[model samples]
Target chain A: MTANPKGGRYRAWGLIVPTGVLYAVTFGIPMAMLLSASFARFEAGRTTPGFFLDNYTRIASDGVTLQVFWNTVTLSAQITAVGLVVAFPVAMLMRRAGPGMRLALMFVLVSPLLTSIIVRNVAWMLILGRSGLINTWLMDWGLISSPLALMYNRLGVIIAVVHVYLPFAVLPIYAALRAIDPARENAAASLGAPPWRVFVHITLPLAMPGVVAAFTLLFILSMGVYLTPVILGGNFVVTLPMMITDVARNQYNWPFASAMSVLLLASIVVVVALASALNRAFSPPRND
Target chain B: MTERSGSPFGYAMLAIFGALVAAFLLLPLVILCIQSFTAESFLSFPPPSYGTRWYRHVAAAANWREAALSSLVIAAIVTPLSLVLGTLAALGLDRGPMRGRGVLYGILISPMILPHIVLGLGIFRIALDLHIDDSLLSIVPAHLTITVPFVVISVGASLQSFDTGLEKAAQSLGASPLRALWHITLPIIRPGLVGGGIFAFIMSFDEFIITYFLSVQTRTLPLEIFSTLRYQVSPAIAAVSALTIAFSAALTVALMMRGQVISAGRIVR
Candidate 1:
């Protein structure tokens, strides 16, 4: 047992064993259990555990639930799209800035992420409040006579969430942009490719991987977000998380909540798999 | 190359967008700070007169003090625990001979991807089964699910770039494996640990869902602010929010500075 090559390997395994056990018990088993609980029925504080289709059937039949699902997908897609458009130019500017300006811009972008989500939501509430900043400014400027309904709506939730998640969107794109070789752009220019053409044909394609990664991250995050919707959307908008909350807490339907969670988890897995597949499809094959 | 002028239009567009984003980012904190100085009790935007009354009120509240204390205590415990566990996991995966290491890594990091509401529900059910629902002990473990992944990623990134030959050299010099790790590896990786620990601390401190679901008797600062926001819209809430924002900003700046120093040191070395 003294200093054998295999003995060192065993030692490493020994170090990892405890953590592996913790992850297995804490995360792995519980996730499997949750998946199973989804198909069962919980009624009157008693869960009848079995394979049942009613829960899935209920999800399909409920119009409001369907609408909420659609809203979640559409909102997530819209946010990802809009986030990319807004972040691209900013990232370009960031890439072109001096050292001090770059640091300042990074801080400005990252500060929103540092602020508590609840605080950001409250800020949105105040801004979208009838007498809050947006409406007040609009009214004062004679843009509109009456206060617009901004708070406790889908639009407000989207605005707040976009603001909250913009940093995530910006940083990745900025990294991708910065990683592009400036010399290549110059070469392309010398080869008679104009600035816009070089950007479209070369830079944008190189940065596509980051765009995909950012979109996937943002979309999944937006799908599962709880606080922004709860605070800003009120009862007007119902996403998957809100539905889960209603089922688990208000209705005391643990099985229903579990069902919703399973659906959410499955969709996320599907999205991630699709993203990876797309990435592989788009990635250039290595000679090695 | 043709003489091309600066695009004033582009600059103006960037400037205006930057200003709007800055306002969106900073106005809430500003409003909260100003409201904290208002003499009036309500959460009015424009204060008739300025005073430090709300700060006094926030400081005077025993519940606020207790919540803040609990938050500090929880963050203190959770941050170190997450750093150790996360670092060990990252190191083990980085160096281990495990089969399907990629899949294992994915599983390790999956907690971050899972909807926290789901995590909350799963943990709540488990806590109920274990009969530790609403205890600080239960809440600490729940927060670990979120914070540990951040630590893992940060530590893993550093570990990926770490030089292994130094450790081997120390081992060849008759230093015990543990001593080599302590003297060689630990110092090199200390910055990652510090940065990851700061992230873990913030994650624990600002956590709302797990604490909201798990804790029965103890409420962290975020939970307090959450409940306050839900039930009322007071200048006091604004004041508390302002303080939390400032605290978070300070921590972030400190972490960024530490990261810069570490990277600069790495470059110099």
Candidate 2:
């Protein structure tokens, strides 16, 4: 934190050169090509080089494209909201646990991440089927007259999404909650503030930065989500990412797909930037 | 420590919600594991009988064997490359007096922000242009774009808190700069490097989108599983999926536990 020696400059450059050069050539070049190719014309499984606004114009004017975009955005927002609401309490509980128990809990929560998205969603297919576990259990308990359709719908997608992505939401808020000096909360509690009040005034405020960070991450992830929605919701519900893949792979419409991708990426960037800005406004200056 | 100071009613609520959520998170994986062992022809949970039938099918499937090997080979190749490059970048930024370091840092981690589908499309587009599509080599760059960030963030965090005085002390004792880095600095941050390597390997191995976009002739395990599932809902894929889930969990725990104890090296930390 205090000093930088004059001597290590060459060594530093040596260290940075590989990834930097690698990224520039591979990542950098591809991105340039993508930007350029997005304007190219696509016909009969082939693309030709040219400048064209038709790709972007089609993305803008198509009613289905507009609806898919709106739906993706709204679904992402909803998923982000749900994940935060659910993860906040779990994170609070995690912070409340002992070290060993906390580790165990962490392992449990992260187990879903260990499974492939395909596997998890496949499992969801079985679990959310009309005769799936929830429905069957409910029927057994005389809580339902018949099996409820949970798969191949928005509700199915949302439930699976929330379950799969819940850990992303929990870890950040837990980090934020864990970082707080317990004395602040204790101070509020000891001053006759009830548990709810203390948490609202002190603990909740402290963890807000983490909540915002988690929300941003989750929102972007939900926006970019392709596999889970398609696997669970089937053809009926199409998110933009799914649409992009469908267009590129099936329709062989690279330019339109690229245009959609560019727009999706731009929107994600704007939202993330806003979220980070909001996070900064909510949190105090870094102790560092 | 004062987290326990909340009211008893609050603690009760925490316990109830925690159990419910944990169960919800775990139910699917558990069902899959059970369904994989089912002797029934169809994948109905609470199977009529259980056996090793599906497991045998998954093991004997030729395409699955190919896909699994491809995934491992690709991940094995990417892991060390990512570690070396990522460590170097982290070291350069952390120790070096580089201007515009934030910009450089952002550029390195930008892949994390760009959605998987976008990056996948970009890589696919470029690959098609260059006629490198469907090659294992083509998948490498895409995986790196995502995996390298984990290394940067992991090693960078470690380097931030590292006692640089140790490196200086080693140098002062007549160790060369590289020698000091190898003997002193690297040992202290070995956890980060190891952790980063593990994360990179898993990420590359588990990645389907990039693989989906790139690989056609040589499918990864995920691609194969996807195709198999798309065609039919057999328990054979469930067996493979369960095995993969086990392998992944085992690999991560084995690596993490075998490493030196650095609290920051853990994913959450």
Instruction: Identify the leading candidate in terms of TM-score.
Output: 2
Model 1 is docked with a DockQ of: 0.37
lDDT of 1 by residue, B169-250 (tens): 9989898878988899888988777767777787788887767667778888878877777534677777777788888788
User: Can you tell me which runs of candidate 1 are displaced by over 4 Å?
Assistant: A284-288, B1-20, B230-232, B260-269
TM-score, model 1, chain B versus true chain B = 0.88
lDDT of 2 by residue, B45-103 (tens): 68889999988887898888888999899999999989988998898888667677888
Residue A197 alpha-carbon offset, candidate 1, angstroms: 1.7
Candidate 2 lDDT over residue span A1-288, tens digit each: 113556655456567888877777667786777777789887777888899887888888888898999999998988898999999989888888777767666766766665678888888877887777678788999999988978788889999999878888888888898898878778887788888898888888888888988898899999999888988888877899999998988798888888888889888988978997998788864555
**Each model's Cα RMSD:** 3.6, 2.9
Tens-digit lDDT track of model 1 for A1-288:
126655565455455565566666567766777888888877677889999876787888987777877888887787778777777777777776677777777767766666778877776776687777678789889999999988788788888888888877777777777777676667777788866787787778777777777777788888898888888888787788888877877787777788888888888888899888877775633313
- Cα deviation at B57, candidate 2, in Å, is 1.5
Q: Second chain TM-score per prediction?
A: 0.88, 0.91
Classify candidate 1 by CAPRI docking class: acceptable
Global lDDT of each candidate: 0.75, 0.81
The candidates' DockQ values read 0.37, 0.52
Q: What is the TM-score of each candidate against the true structure?
A: 0.91, 0.93
